[model samples]
Target: MTRVLVPLLRASCPPGAGGYGGSIELRLPDSEAERLGGVALVRAALRAAARELGWKAETFGWTGTIHGTMVGVTDRRTPPAPFDSVVDADRQRRMRDAVDRVGRPGTPSLPPTDEPSARLPTEEFLTAYAAAQGVVDR
Candidate 1:
C-alpha cells in the first residue's frame, strides 16, 4: 500500500484560513483493495496513515472517498478521484490510462483516450462511495 497526502485548496478562502485540511490517499494493488471491501479498506488505510504520521487513528479526523479500488481520506472533506477532478481533459485521460496500466507489466500500455465511455468505475468504488456517504452501514 502507498500513502499520498494532497493539500486542499480553495479560491474563496483566505491563504491561511482554510484550516489545516488535506486528503490522504491509500493506494494498493487492485485485487487486494477489492478483497478488503470499502469500509474495511478505509479503516485499514486510516490506521496505516495514523501510524505513518505518528498520530492515533481515533483522533486523526479524516473523511474518506473511494474511486475504483483507491481510497482517499481527507482532514475536512472527501476529495474527488484524481481522474474526475482534474480540469484538463488530456490530463484526466492520462491519469485514467495510468491507473488502468497498473500491475500489468507485460501487456502493452494503451495510449490515453478521450472517450467518456472509457471511464471505468468498479463495484468496489460504488460500495466504498456509498459507505462514505452513509447510505450503507460499514
Candidate 2:
C-alpha cells in the first residue's frame, strides 16, 4: 500500500510582510502536484497560504493585507518544525532568494527511508532557509 505523507509548512508574518507557509498536505494520487518538483510544490504551498491569508482577512473584515514567512514544515505523520516564530526582515530576503534559486526542475528527494524527499535544488534552498531561520537540525 502507498504511504500517505502530509507535508505542511508554517508561517509567521505581519501585515504586508511577504513569504509563504508550510504545507500540511501533499494531495497525492489524483493531484498533478505530485508529478511536479519540490519547487512546484513549494509554489503551490505559497499560493495556498496566500489564499488562506486572504480568506482570513475577509473573514475578519480587515482591509489590510498580510504576508508570511515560513516558520517550519510539518508532516502530521512526522514531526513538524521544532521552532515557531516570525522571521526577521533580513532573513526574509535570504528565504526569498533561496526559494527563487530553487527553480530547477526535479522532485525533492525525501531523505532515505521514511524521510521526506525534496528536489535537489529545492532541498538545498530549504536547507539554506532553515539555516537562515537559525535551525540547527531537523
Candidate 3:
C-alpha cells in the first residue's frame, strides 16, 4: 500500500476567520486496504505519528484513486479565510520557512506550495472517465 503524510495548516484569513489547506494524496494498490485493515487504520496510524510529534491530524474521504491524510498542528484561535481567497505566495513562503525551522533536521527541501487558483481535479476526473470508457486499464 502507498502511504503519504501531508502537512496542514490554518490559512491566513482576515480578523475572526480562518481556513484549512495544504494536503497531499497517497496512491496505493487497492488490495493494500485489505491488508491494512481499511483506510481507518491507516488514518489512525498517521494521527498517532503526528501526535507523537505534537501535531494534530485529521482525515478526509478520498475523491480519487489517491487517498489523502492531513496532519499538522491546528490553530483554533485563528479564523479561516473566506471562500474567495485563501493564501498568496508571500504567505506560502512564510509558512514553508516556518515549517523548515520547526521540522526535523535534514528534511528534504519542499517544492513550491502555492495554489494559484481554486481548481478541482479535472484531470483526474478525466482520467477516470477515460478508464470508464474502456480506453485503458484502471
Residue 91, model 1, lDDT: 39
Tens-digit per-residue lDDT, 1-138, candidate 2: 001111223223322333322222222222222333333444444445435443221111111123122211322121224322232443465455555455435745333443233343244444554565577873
Error of 1 at 13 (Å): 15
TM per candidate comes to: 0.25, 0.20, 0.32
Would you list the rank order by lDDT, best first? 1, 3, 2
Once superposed on the true structure, which residue ranges of model 1 sit more than 4 Å away at CA?
1-19, 26-30, 34-42, 47-67, 77-138
lDDT for model 3, on a 0 to 1 scale? 0.38
Best by TM-score: 3
Give per-residue CA lDDT, model 3, range 1-138, as digits (tens): 111222222122222323333332334344644344555665565455444433334544332254422212232222134522443443466566768655657776556446432122223422444455565854
